[model samples]
Target: MKRSRAVSLGILGAAAFGLAACQTEEQTDAAAFSDEQSCVAAAAQSGWFTREDCAATFAEAKAVHEETAPRYESQALCEEEHGAGACGGDPAAASGGGGGSIFMPLLAGYLIGQALGGGRAMAQPVVPKAGGGFATPTGGTQLSRLNSTGKMGTTAFAKGPTTAGQPPMSRAAVASRGGFGGSAATRSVGS
Candidate 1:
């Protein structure tokens, strides 16, 4: 009887651990701003973020945008995904020895989130979507507008795969990238 009870308790503990692992991701306070000045302005009033935090996070977001924003083989394809006037020539590709002209969406905004453990803040770059919204580089999170504040999953700050130094994506490749709603599919550049 004693051994049976111990085994039952062990099973229950394991079940509890498994359930905990399936819990939803933790949420954090986050906000979106169209630019650094706007974030700084909000920081002065909200007290959740500081001016320094705004600047640093915005810079980080810009770098992430340049590194991770999806690249297209043509302006038409990029515009199709990002909307007209929202796409631009890839700066890295234009600098020389980049193979050919590449296009990508412009950085539409930035998201700043309170770190889960309360250290420094976190940031993610947002780009314009075809239907008039904003999304992270991975298209895992979408927001309707900038200058908004709310609770967001910590995963919103996660960086997407780097597109820098990679071959530009063709229309079919972009169609199949499948990153929306966090259901990203990994595929080789040439495949």
Candidate 2:
């Protein structure tokens, strides 16, 4: 009985040891690339592999194409997954098949931002005037700012030197009821 108990304990210890070895997370991930998509995603996630790496390893893994080693989707998709100029196909031809150069979209986004003045370091804020006129903080280069009715009023005009003989063109100083209905002023250039 004593010998049998010892043998059973030894067997149990060996089984525990074997089970412990199976719980390791360091299992090899090298063969994790069962297909091109998974391999591309993994390699791209590492940020080390390029498009050539994808074509060479992934495409070659499955005998991708007869003409090409590993056929790629589109330049745009490839560039997105890899880097610029990473795709194997012609960029123009791939436009209908897949998106083209990624730079063009980025460039277009930059231009759109610039056109809306969103890219400016300091954008001019819309200032509220007493006569319901909206103007920039500095009143801009224009002599008069537009009012709510889309008409140029005298509420927020940039003040220049008053003419020696001519009267002021803006009625901004004139006090009116309900903040509207002020007399129109004629703006004049150099006399």
TM-score of each: 0.82, 0.17
Number of clashing pairs per prediction, in order: 0, 0
Which run of 10 residues does model 2 get worst, by summed lDDT? 104-113
- Tens-digit per-residue lDDT, 64-163, candidate 1: 9999998889999888888999999999889966567999999998999899776999999998888777878766567777887877756567788899
Give candidate 1's whole-model lDDT.
Answer: 0.74
The local distance difference test score of each candidate is 0.74, 0.23
The prediction achieving the highest lDDT against the true structure is 1
lDDT of 1 at 30: 83
The candidate that wins on TM-score is 1
Tens digits of per-residue lDDT, candidate 2, 1-191, equal: 00000000121121101112223211111112223454345444543343345445433322211111111233343233223543344333335354332211110000000112222211112222232222222222111221111111122122323221222112232233111111222123211
Window of ten residues with lowest summed lDDT in model 1: 1-10
Off by over 4 Å in 1: 1-21, 178-191
